[model samples]
Target: MYNDKVMKSALESMMFVWGEPLKVKDAAEVLDADKKVVKDLFLDLQREYAMMGRGIRIREVDGAFQFVTHAENEIFIEKLCTPVKVKKLSQAALEVLAIIAYRQPVTKGEIDSIRGIKSERVIDGLMSKDLVDVAGRSEGVGRPLLYKTTGEFLKKFGFASIKDLPDITEFDDIEEYDEETPHEQLSINFEGDADSEDK
Candidate 1:
């Protein structure tokens, strides 16, 4: 049985330092406690918060655990935490990125048709920011390049995996758009560019 002091310390460390989601096994190893014991402690803490109607609570999402503000206290939490500045995304770029993220393994031509705009610059920006990458080439004529999201994209957006993306129940739901939006697309070249190649 973990002591109250130990459990409180562990929970504080998890909330402060380990800002990202952590697994029970990982937390156990860090706290030097059995996994089951840590889980029990977590459950107790969660229940206590629920009974008290606390503003913060520990949550399990996709098997990873993290501390999050209670739904009712979101506005208060936002006021306490530093406000996150979001970069604006143009309608054209947003449309292009939406199509690419949802219909990955798609080609530039297909993206252009969907958005009715030349996607070269948009794709270039995404590649420059390392958000998107050439997954492969299409089998069709000209062998157009295929694109997909990168690990950096997931990290920047605080997603454990692509599958962790929020459900798109309704296309018109703006609340679903709270997740990361494309700021500046990064470009990455797997093959050495001309400058590196010259060296």
Candidate 2:
């Protein structure tokens, strides 16, 4: 009662509906067929797609299969979508981001000491933008959430890795170039942006 063509069509339908990776056993269970049959049918469809010059292809990752665009078509997709994906960051956010990037797993208190301000809102914004994330909790008092730059930060900044960051020595004289308050030195732009702790 198992028609090969009908089974193949059903497999495609299941994959499309899932909208994510589909495993061989999962597809077979849904179709009430042997796992080997499902895998063979999936392979057949993959070959057919390649031969048909389709923009999308089925790929296996970690023992699961999913539909993904061909690598050659990525540039076109980026051209169509990069602007909306790239959001601008404020100066304060950048400073906080830089500190987290260079000194990962650091607590907000540490950041406050270096930048001389309470960075609650700035850190919130960075988290919302997916540029920074809570790496873990510190062991000391209160077990404060430690923060670090995310992989998305590297991708957005075009850094291959953290080590690709420019040498800190190259920026040695940058501090002396400005005569503003400590807030300005760290480039944090917020109301009460000046040091209020010593106020």
Candidate 3:
């Protein structure tokens, strides 16, 4: 049986390799331990990082966890290395993403109707960026594919889970909006070596 110290150490190493949020259930299965114990251990690790004010911190999103730099150290990190620039998401992309995020497992038809425009290109872009993905096929007329936000969404938005989305009034008043690309840009800075491919 893995002792608490050993289990925690193993979990830390696993999280570092996982890069993405490590699911408690997956970790428990690998370690042959109960999920509850693993979850508590993950929580303990999270608390320890916070208490120690470590430069690299663990963040729990939903039931999974991942390592993210401390927001407090953003300036120092940027000064130390050139930050990778992720292409700024367009307004249309933002609108489509919002719709998909709010009404996840939503159909393409539903998204188009809500936006009053076709979002094929925008959805494709979101998919390529790993923000949205196909959840499954709808049982409707043509059995259209269902789209939903992924774990990357939670990490980028700093949300613990989808349930953390704040209360917002419906977009029922959205009668007809032009699909024009606005000058507004939402900059997202991700930590990594700058790649020319991203440009």
Top model number, lDDT: 3
lDDT of 1 by residue, 1-199 (tens): 4586787667767855887666778878877788888777777776777788776666554445566666656556558769766454455655666667667788999988766678999888878877789999999999989998866555445454667554555533433464443222211111111111110
lDDT of model 2, residue 131: 76
Residue 130 C-alpha lDDT in model 2: 83
Q: In terms of TM-score, which candidate is strongest?
A: 3
> How many angstroms is residue 99 displaced in model 1 relative to the true structure, after the best TM-score fit?
1.4
Task: Record all residue pairs in model 2 with backbone atoms less than 3 Å apart, i.e. clashing.
Answer: none
lDDT of each: 0.63, 0.67, 0.75
lDDT of 3 by residue, 73-176 (tens): 66676688775665667778887887887688999899999888999999999999998999999999999999999877667666678887644455453333
Write the number of the candidate with greater TM-score, choosing between 2 and 3: 3
Winner on TM-score (1 vs 3): 3
Evaluate model 1: give its lDDT: 0.63
The RMSD of every model to the true structure, in order and in angstroms, is: 11.4, 12.6, 5.4
